[model samples]
Target: MPRKPTKGYWVRGHFVAYGSEEDSELKRAAKWDADLSKTDLKKRSAHLQAVGEQLLTLKPSLLQGLDLPPSLREALAEAKRIDDFEGRRRQLQYVGKLMRQLDDALVATIEATLAEQHRASAAQTERLHAAEHWRERLVADDAALDAWRELEPDADWQRLRALIRQARKDAQVHPDPAPGQAQRKGRAWRELFQHVRAVLDAHESPSTVARP
Candidate 1:
């Protein structure tokens, strides 16, 4: 009869223990594969390229806060000068490559700066829209003046009324252009918007005297 195989059996004359060296090797291989999948070269390069493009859109004043290296700064400048489609693309690729060598913390700072700028821009847009809405309401309805006065009692009532009247008259005299023509606002209309914006801004300012 053949010898009974033990816990450490011999496979082709070499000792093969179950769940020992073989299991360790298998685990190591799996971890290596996982690491490779996570740090895919192509994916990293693409992400860096996208970040470079976003950086290009930011104003030079804003970019000064990023404190990029001299080489990277030069790369961005060169990239900006590249007007040809393919040349710009290649320059941007080079920028991405340079970016990859930068500290991760620097990248985070750049991203945060961009995010803050976007938030500020959105807030400005909201304020402009609010001003426009108030201007339109004041011009269209006489009662809107009463509501506005209640909110801003210190406002110059005479000037505000005059502006609104002129804006309305201008709108009537220069009626909307034909469908194909570009509708352009007249001077009075623009002045009314400016006056309304100033009043709203004053109300929001801390220096303005609040009602008792």
Candidate 2:
């Protein structure tokens, strides 16, 4: 009887037999974390599949900027359009296969892009929180204006004062709640939040202001 044939895929014209010594070396060279075994290979495949799924969620302009093969791009594009459950699973498997063919550098680029986007999303949340904090303080205390002025010396102080005054007035007037409905502050409340957000967006951070 003939010996069982090895199973693998080709990488850059070289056939990489799964879980073989050569496979382990290539993985190490690519800076992958684990020693290759049948199990590790499965984990690697699943990881690549997850990365491929993340690629599907990439913005269209960012996706276009990636240096991907035409076939992989088409597969990713098709995966987005697939509405059928089984069909998407099969298409994603195909995407995972293509992802494996990518060189180590391109894989690093994909990871970096995802990480950068994550940081950007976090910064946006932080900015919104900072704005809310300032808006609350300004509406409650006249002294908060001095702290805000120190942070943004170039801000339109008069405009901020007008918004804060109106927001405070709106906050003091309480109306009876209708059933489950909460008390809604007037437009100035919203405008105060927006104004603070604009100032915060223009600067790095309140703590980083050119402190005396």
Candidate 3:
């Protein structure tokens, strides 16, 4: 008797035999597509969850403009109350699910808020660094005094000179002391930082005046 016909199907010009390599490959391709689709959805969910967590970091007053759904708003509030790591994770997941049902406008709002916060933080950091640079220059170089005087003609030059002298002396006496021990020998250095920061702040905001 002739051998039973090999089980197979045709696709285009190729015959894919059952239990053959070609048939196995076809199944794998189909499964891969399904897996890829699921993976994309998972990634979207994770991204939404991250956005929700970032929104939670903002103050409630700042969130008032977003006009978020009641369910999402409540979820964010509840997430804050959940101190447990796993519980917060679950709550955030729920928030992500809710986010999927909402429009893209909410995501855009959250991103914009975060961007503004980052810009403000960067500006504050730049101000702090400028103050620190001025402090160091005033202490280490005598000519820096003239530069500062040119910038702030109304500053109490006499008092600032005295503070700088004392600060330099204090720094020499307690060079590289432990973190909190800098004030043990004298607070002159700390006072100098405060004075420089005040001067810079006043310069940045001309309406404000540096305190004596």
Winner by TM-score? 2
TM-score to true structure, per model:
0.72, 0.75, 0.68
Q: Rate the local accuracy (lDDT) of all candidates.
A: 0.75, 0.80, 0.76
TM-score of 1: 0.72
Which candidate model has the greater lDDT, 2 or 3? 2
Candidate 1 per-residue lDDT, tens place, 72-162, comes to: 8999999889899999988998888777766668988888888888876775566677678888888899988887776578878888888
Over the stretch 1-212, how does candidate 3's per-residue lDDT look in tens digits?
A: 99998889998988999997557657755654677687776786678777877888776567887888888899989998999999988998888767765556768888898778777676666667777787888889998888777557888888899999998898888777677663454687788888877766656552232221
The superposed Cα distance between candidate 3 and the true structure at residue 22, in angstroms, equals 42
**Global lDDT for candidate 1?**
0.75
lDDT of 2 by residue, 49-93 (tens): 899899987777777788998989999889989999999999999
Candidate 3 regions with alpha-carbon error over 4 angstroms: 1-41, 178-185, 202-212
- Order of quality (TM-score): 2, 1, 3
Worst 10 residues of 1 by lDDT: 203-212
Candidate 1 vs candidate 2, lDDT winner = 2
